[model samples]
Target: MNRDDGPLFGGRAWLPALLIVPMFLGFAFLGVQGGTVIGTLTLAAVVVWAIRANPEGPIEIAAPGEGVRGGVLVVLLAPIDDPPVAGVLAAITDPSRREAGEPLLLAPTRIGRLDRFFGDIEAARFESQRVLAVSVATLAAAGIEVEGRVGDDDVVLAAEDTLRTYAATEVVVFAPGEDDDGAIAKLERRLGIPLRRID
Candidate 1:
């Protein structure tokens, strides 16, 4: 599994020991003054390391090569009862597209800060399901057969998760407009597969 996909200290069991062993030895043998100095320096170094490491950095998505099957993963930002934009539909329906497993339509739960803080995700989940239902129906009407799923709140994370289970040849994202968070650019860089954005 990718390091980015794991928990912060998941595989690296030595990290805690490496960090604490020296401090413990210093405090035991060097007395209070030296131990205080060592502890302060260690704390500073840890802060610097965390900053440089950027744990929330971009997730690495493997490109779907010949080993993987072909299909499309459509990420919907909103309910789409109407037909999707031309670019999106064309990418999904293009005859020249590589064949793969069944297509999937994914909608990420969009929960507000306050609602999430209060653990009130029911509304968000409901909204995501609604998006999937409407989008699936719309795509079905267009003669495209695709399964639907609700994913994580973070769009990029949701795509990454879906890609793990579904080896989609291409990913098409439908957003109302350009997002201030630069989600499209991140997806283009990290998805590895061909990414199409319709706004």
Candidate 2:
């Protein structure tokens, strides 16, 4: 969902009406048959529209407080933009990393979509950056030592790049959904580092 998309059907109140009009007209014309076809088409249209319109689901990540230095790397996924996730950021981050004024790098990855083709790349990338920016700000406000944050569309590529760039002792993943496990596991195997998730 791009910032330009304007808040989930924002100004487009007529879309549902547009769908309903045909069904009503069909019912008036050919009685049951026409109404059924239009009704089916309308249902399909609504499903497609909903899939395209709705935003990503929330992924909540929280962990108990642990104090350590700058040896842990954090990779954030969706729902990190939510303010409540900030407490998790504070928990996983090492207070010493902030106290020593060290710049902790947090990589935010937005999953790519098969629906977004070449022409749609710019808008998609912009939306991804927008989401990542919010997550970064949320983490920063929690006093996490995130000096700089990186954004990527592919989760595995981002994890590989993060591992290559940072000499982190361990890894923490902030993903809170069952469907994400396979992707997270792929990253874990590629990095060859133990990836801990907040249950």
| Candidate topping TM-score | 1
Q: What lDDT, from 0 to 1, does candidate 2 have? A: 0.59
Model 1, range 34-146, lDDT digits (tens) per residue? Answer: 88889888889878766666445445544566675448777899876766463357556565665534577889998899999999999999999999998877777777777
- The stretch of ten residues in a row with the least summed lDDT in candidate 2 is 56-65
Give the per-residue lDDT digits (tens) of candidate 2, residues 1-199.
3544454566676655677888998899979998999889888977887778743322212221344223566666653665666786576565655422233445454534654444356665555566557666777777664654655666666655555545555577777677454767766655544567753
TM-score of 2: 0.51
Point to the candidate with the largest lDDT: 1
Ten contiguous residues minimizing lDDT sum, candidate 1: 54-63
List where candidate 1 sits over 4 angstroms from the true fold.
Answer: 2-16, 29-52, 55-70, 84-91, 94-96, 99-101
How high is the lDDT of residue 188 in model 1? 77
